[model samples]
Target: MLKGNREQELIELAQKMIQAKSYSGEEKQAAETIGEFCKANGFDDVIYDRYGNVIGIIKGNRPGPKVLFDGHIDTVPVSDESKWTQKPFAGEIVDGKLYGRGTSDMKGAVSAFTAAAKYFAEDTNRDFAGEILIAGVVHEECFEGIAAREISKNFKPDYVIIGEASQLNVKIGQRGRGEIVVETFGKPAHSANPEKGINAVYKMSKVINAIRDLVPTEHPVLGKGILELTDIKSAPYPGASVVPEYCRATYDRRLLVGETKESVIAPIRELLDKLMAEDSELKAKVSYAVGEEMCYTGNKIEGERFFPGWLYDQDEAWVQAVVKELNNAGFNPEITQYNFCTNGSHYAGEAGIKTLGIGPSRENLAHTVDEYIEIEQLTKVCECYYGVMKALLV
Candidate 1:
């Protein structure tokens, strides 16, 4: 259980994080604060990766499996401050809730694991085995698994715990997210003589209709792999008396297990090919969207938007071990899965490591007007993380 002073420390750490306001690609202040906390605590060493990820290493006296507590430090921007009852960056505590921008989305989880690692290391005095690595990952809001690739390469942890919002439920899997781009091409001509030009918008319409007809794949547990048209734009903003010659559309794809990049676009490409065969003038292309962002450390991080989905059977040994310990610790966490994508997409979906997401708040609270996390949830999750370490760091 979390004690009074430890709980107070955890609350203060989360407050400082909320006050820092670290948006995507701008997490230096929050990162520095986390690093300072790790150093002031019992962490043996703290290092910033090339991408400005703050990693705190607490090694036990004996060697065993490496357990990583992963949480992203960046957050979505607060679009309107006036609409929020609580200031987004103030980190105010009201009626047992700590209000701020990144509290629920994830700075609260980061602070939990940070304080948990400190308490665990001090309580054991490094008498246990294995390693406890608490990482403050960056750029997760922009690229789900890109920076995590760096962390995996650096630590090669035996297991990963993603501190995504799970409302204290034990998440075993998720339907990953992918951004698919489709474009159409045609010849431009004067609107006065529209028949002389092939309107790209018309060409794109055919593709959109075909996509609408495509069936979404289904999973027994993770639900269907749904695809929806999100954005579409033509080359010319204002027709300008000319027929538009190019159209681009982006689709949000919810990925399921066993779906790959080639598999995802294959059906769309087949439809495009069939359309092209019927009409020789029709031209288009489809591919995954590539994302590139500048990190706060002045480093560049980029990746394809095809974050893979993953799942684990509830009967897996580690899964049961964690459930047993958390249950024994007075946390009745249900064995479940996240409804949205998370950093687990990289660790479990891409890197093929066993992963679990167990965090402190509701997912819907993220990116809202007045985002906040309960102090009770924060302290409970700190104890929960410690329980995970005790269960796995054998």
Candidate 2:
């Protein structure tokens, strides 16, 4: 068990991080807090990127592999504030649970990693083998895997510790995700002369039905690929007497390990191809988000299908190091994979870094109203983080 004062400090830090409202695209305050903590704790270096990612480094007296503690400080937007028992940013601690918007989705992990880094630094005079880095990234929810992509270009590490809620267990892999868009076009005509005009909406309805019956692809770890229709829009203003000329639909697709962007988009593209065969006016395309922003519209179209799925062998040395430390900390750690996507994909997939997911809290509680994390569990995570750092360093 953690000492009483250590537990209190852990809770206090979790609350502090929770109190800072670091919603996506507005992570400056939380980034500042992390930077300040790193500076005050005597980190060798603390830096922030233009995208508001906060990175703190603690170099070991001896040199070896570079291990990174990765987490996202940004959170999903909170709605229905009235539904929460405490203010989302108040950082309330009730009945041993720290409650706030970012509590479970990940501020707790950020705090845990920060405290663990401090612990390692305090014992820095001891002999160690590697460098430890704590990275609080931004724009995770808005743009998946973008944070680590940027980090890899600069501070590439041998191993990445993704600080997502895994009940302090070790996560070996996760499925990939992609965004898809399908559009239909037709000639517009007055409603009174409906027979003279092809209704794009009606044509799109057929494709939507077809997709509804499409089964998800299966994977060994990630379970299955899923397709969800997220957005739909029609061209031209809705009028009582006008047939729609264009219709567009957007889908969010979760990809498994064996699944590729082409595989996910092929079925839908095939649907559009079938439509095009019958009517040359119908058209569709599949794409992902780019790193572009417009001031007025904030329209970020799909950029590239670069986010890939990856896995770290649980028996690898780095993973064994993590398991040994976790076991020493009284956790019978289990090997698992995150059901959702994370920056780990970028490190392990794009950058070829050995990355594993480990943090506190139940994965299901993330991104929900009344989000909270167990103070006891967080304390354990701090110890776990400390042990992992010490094991790698020494």
- TM-score of candidate 2 against the unseen true structure: 0.92
RMSD of each: 0.9, 2.8
Q: Candidate 2, clashing residue pairs? A: 128-393, 129-393, 288-302, 288-303, 289-302, 289-303, 290-303
Candidate 2, 159-213: lDDT as tens digits = 7888899998889998777777777787789999988888888878877887798
> Clash number for every model?
0, 7
Task: Choose the strongest candidate by TM-score.
Answer: 1
Error of 2 at 142 (Å): 0.9
Cα lDDT, all candidates: 0.92, 0.79
Q: Give the per-residue lDDT digits (tens) of candidate 1, residues 293-320.
A: 9999999998999899999999999999
Top model number, lDDT: 1
- TM-score of every candidate relative to the true structure: 0.99, 0.92
